[model samples]
Target: MAKKVWVERNKDGSWDAFGDDGAHIKFGHGQGLFDPGDLMKLALAGCAALSSQVAVESTLGEGKGATISVDGTYDDELKGFASFKEQIELDASSAGLHNEDVEKFKERVQKHIERSCMVMHTYEHATPVSEEITVKQ
Candidate 1:
């Protein structure tokens, strides 16, 4: 079973997310920069990194440890208050992963991320936001 995840939105329009007793993550909400909404693409990249490992381990059988790192590019033009395009670059070791196998992993990770990446799915379809304001006269 996966660990529980929780997030608390902050005053600067950022959100802090915590997972299982691990380090907390702060997501920013900037227009031209990385924002809370942008987490979708990053989530795709991140999940792909781990999923690639899963696919690798399952295929190659257990041996030494392996890892994958992913980075993404989000088109600023299309990235409005809503939609955007996501591109991911994956890096891995050559021992357990051949060039063709790595390519396969990339494609597999992309497909799986589309189905399971929460942030992407949420933003791509529906976004629910609520604002609380206190005024002084």
Candidate 2:
């Protein structure tokens, strides 16, 4: 099944993105609205959290959560992101993982995220995007 997503301009001169699943997010220029670049960063972070969930919970016990933070540098001349960094924070001490166990757990989660995060994979592989515009009379 194919999911549909679209952006529509608002009466107030802002824009919003909507998904066929009823997801909505405010975009474009405005306070409290996420620009496209912001969304891209968020997507990477969100993907990391999800892809690493199993490894984290398996090591830290169920219901234990992790925070994934993403930062990137944009290259104005290249019109693209120059670099990206992601940090995953979890309380291994609270989970009783010490010494080698903590190190192994971190490695496992990192490997899992690197392999399974589609968003990150796409970004790393430089997926191409094509635009199609429709005009109505």
TM-score of 2: 0.92
lDDT of 2 by residue, 26-128 (tens): 8887798887888889999999999999998888889877887888999999898988888889887677666888789889999989899999988888677
Candidate 2 backbone overlaps, count: 0
Q: Which predicted model would earn the best lDDT?
A: 2
| lDDT per model vs. reference | 0.60, 0.88
Cα lDDT of model 1 by residue, 1-137, tens digit: 87889888888777788888696877766654456545655665556545445554555456522343334455668665534555544435544687798777667756766666665566567667898888999
- What TM-score, to 2 decimals, does candidate 1 have? 0.45
- The numbered model that scores best in TM-score is 2
What is the Cα-based lDDT of residue 96 in candidate 2? 68
Give the TM-score of each candidate. Answer: 0.45, 0.92
The alpha-carbon lDDT assigned to residue 17 of candidate 1 equals 88
